[model samples]
Target: MSDPLDKATSKAPATLGEGCLSRYDPDDLSSEDGTEFPGAAELWEQLQDTSDSPEEQASAAAQGRH
Candidate 1:
């Protein structure tokens, strides 16, 4: 068995936020390059499949009665 203090020290240190890995001083940074991805929201909405066809939905309803 390990001591409580030893077990605590064996684990890694925690950061401030869930998604953040390291601290950032935004004032020290500058941006470069000009690559762009446009219409991302429109493309995502178009790609989603919300409903099935009328025939498929009707067939599914019929099968579920069993």
Candidate 2:
């Protein structure tokens, strides 16, 4: 893996008191404790995107999409 701290890396370290949404709960993305993001069904529904056709799914998978 590439070193994120290497000088070549363009990534900048977060300033003090920085809080990343993705790091709200590293162990559980759902944030079941409710301290961070609430476990909202609407969010999950939006992520599924059932409107996409089967061909689109195959194309996305072939392109290495999550």
Candidate 3:
């Protein structure tokens, strides 16, 4: 309790899976984990709407190759 460095230390939540698939377990998360993202779906939809389709992007790239 007297060590100032110990007060600055933090720990991460438990994870599941391994390697690229590893992620924090949802069941172990709480409000303190900062997992809430109310705007995530809206942001995803906005991004999807603004981005070009794969076919359009491929065609644009093909034109530059000529």
Using TM-score as the measure, which candidate wins?
A: 3
**Clash totals for all models, in order?**
0, 0, 0
State in Å the error of residue 53, model 1: 8.0
Residue-wise C-alpha lDDT for candidate 3, range 1-66, written one tens digit per residue: 497867776668899999999999999999998999999999997886559687876876798831
After superposing candidate 1, which stretches have Cα over 4 Å from the reference? 1-35, 50-66
* Candidate 2 or 1, higher lDDT: 2
lDDT of 2 by residue, 1-66 (tens): 886668573433333434563333334333344446456777886777676689988988898983
Ranking of models by TM-score? 3, 2, 1
lDDT tens readout by residue for model 1, 8-52:
634333334445557444444334322234787777756542355
Which of candidates 2 and 3 is the stronger one according to TM-score?
A: 3
Best candidate, lDDT-wise? 3
TM-score of each: 0.23, 0.28, 0.62
The better candidate by lDDT, 1 or 3, is 3
By descending lDDT, how would the candidates be arranged? 3, 2, 1
User: Which of candidates 1 and 3 is the stronger one according to TM-score?
Assistant: 3
RMSD of each: 12.9, 14.1, 6.8
Candidate 3's C-alpha runs over 4 A off are: 1-8, 53-66
Model 2: CA > 4 A from native: 1-48
lDDT of 3 at 60: 67
Give the total clashing residue pairs for model 1: 0
